[model samples]
Target chain A: EAGVAQSPRYKIIEKRQSVAFWCNPISGHATLYWYQQILGQGPKLLIQFQNNGVVDDSQLPKDRFSAERLKGVDSTLKIQPAKLEDSAVYLCASSLGTGNGYTFGSGTRLTVV
Target chain B: AQSVTQPDIHITVSEGASLELRCNYSYGATPYLFWYVQSPGQGLQLLLKYFSGDTLVQGIKGFEAEFKRSQSSFNLRKPSVHWSDAAEYFCAVGEGGNTPLVFGKGTRLSVIA
Candidate 1:
């Protein structure tokens, strides 16, 4: 099967600017997730969507980060007033359900200057 | 708080030699464990997962992991190494409910001949 798809493999933005990342999960998957992976660190979940309804967003920085999954298939992650620290890889993943495993996208690498 | 630990930040082994990557997770109840591999500029790919049934589980690319409840460990092992196997390996954990996976700071492997 075709893997999860992401757009703009790399991005560069100035501090305080806005940026967006897009993700398309595998067909028929019911769960979508957004994660942030900083350099030298592991990926951290920012938000999770179960068929368009948010399941979790406890770790997301609400002031700057927001995510949405439309029709429970494609998702987008946005960061407004991006901070220099926001430079990292934003990854998207999906799964069939709670018990199933996840497949990740190549990620959008953001370089905040 | 729940967390995952990768003891080795980097590992180097010669080609055709045995390989091991240690992963330790902290959680209250029975956990969902996973191992993911990330190539340069690529997204994460599932290596194996431990949900139940078997303690020792095999995955793609000749990789296997043993989940030990008592030790809180799910260490990845490979009988022999290949240069193509050099990549960053991550350990992740997820609890029941809609909680997203918590990842460990990956272990970067380097294979030499």
Candidate 2:
């Protein structure tokens, strides 16, 4: 089966600029996740979606970051007024459920100057 | 709180030699452990996982990991290293059945011919 798909493999933006990333999960997968992986750091979970509803987003910066999975299929993550610290690779993954291993996309590498 | 730690930031090994990467986690309950590998400019891929059964779990590409509940560790091992094995490896922990994963910084493996 096809793996998760993401758009704009790379992005560069100035600090305080707005940016958005898109993710298309695998077919028949019930769980979708977005993670931020900074250089020399592990991928951090930004949000998780089970179907069209959010399961967890405690780590998300509500003031500037927002994510949504509409129709229980495709998802999008947006960061307004980006910061230098936001420079990292944003990865999208999908799983059948929490019990199964995840399949990930190539990711979108974002650089905020 | 749940957290993961990959003690080694990087490791170097010669091709055909054995390899091992360390991972430790802290959590309140019985944790679900996982190991993932990420190649340059690629997304994370599941290498192995440990939920409840055997401590030793085999993964794709000649990888395996042993979960030690006593030490709260899950270390990845490969009997013979290959040049293609050079990549970043991440360890993650999860609580509940399908909760968001908590990940460690990662260990970058360098293989020499």
Candidate 3:
């Protein structure tokens, strides 16, 4: 099976700039997730979508980070006015459903200068 | 709220030696557990998962994990460490449907000959 796909293996932008990352989940998967992994830290859940409808975004910084999984297939995560602290690897993952392990994409590495 | 903890930040072992990565999770209900491995500049790959039925679950690359309810732990084990096994390992917990997985900080394993 094809793995989850992500675009822009790496990105570099100045602080306060805007950046976007794209993700394509495995075929037929119903759940998509976005996570931010900082250096020396665990990956934190940024948002979750269950077939286009948001299931969770409480941890997302709504003022700066936004995510959408339109048509319940592909997802995009955007960080507007990106902070210096926003420099990290953004990972996308998908699963068949509950009780199954997730398949992760190669992630987008963002560097804010 | 759900959280995961990987007590070891890094570990080094001689090649062909046994290895163990500890993971502890906090959740109220019956929890779904997972172990993932990430090489540098790469995405996460599922090592194994525990939903139910068996306490010990085997995964790819000769990895296995044991889930202990009383310990609130799911520790990954490998009988013979190889140089390729040097990577970061993460432990995660998730609820069934809508909830996203909560990940640990990850343990970095270094293999020496």
Can you tell me the DockQ of model 3? 0.79
Instruction: Report the lDDT of model 3 for residue A59.
Output: 92
Give the per-residue lDDT digits (tens) of candidate 1, residues A18-43: 99999999998888999899999999
Docking class of 3: medium
In angstroms, the error of model 3 at B39 is: 0.7
**How far is A104's C-alpha from truth in model 2 (Å)?**
1.1
Query: Which pairs of residues collide in candidate 1?
Result: none
In terms of TM-score, how similar is model 3 to the real structure? 0.97
**Chain B structural similarity as TM-score, candidate 3:** 0.98
Tens-place lDDT digits, model 3, residues A3-74: 999999999999999999999999999999999999988899899898999988999999999999899999
lDDT by residue (B1-111, candidate 2, tens digit) is 899999999999999999999999999778888899999999998998888888999999999999888999999999999999999999999875668788999999999
TM-score of chain A of each: 0.96, 0.98, 0.98
Instruction: Place model 2 in a CAPRI quality band.
Output: medium
RMSD from true fold, candidate 1 = 1.1
TM-score of each: 0.97, 0.96, 0.97
Question: What's the C-alpha lDDT at position B12 in model 3?
Answer: 99
Q: List pairs with backbone clashes in candidate 2.
A: none
Model 3, runs deviating above 4 Å: none
Cα lDDT tens digits, model 1, B1-113, are 78999999999999999999999999988899999999999999998988889899999999999999999999999999999999999999987555688999999999999
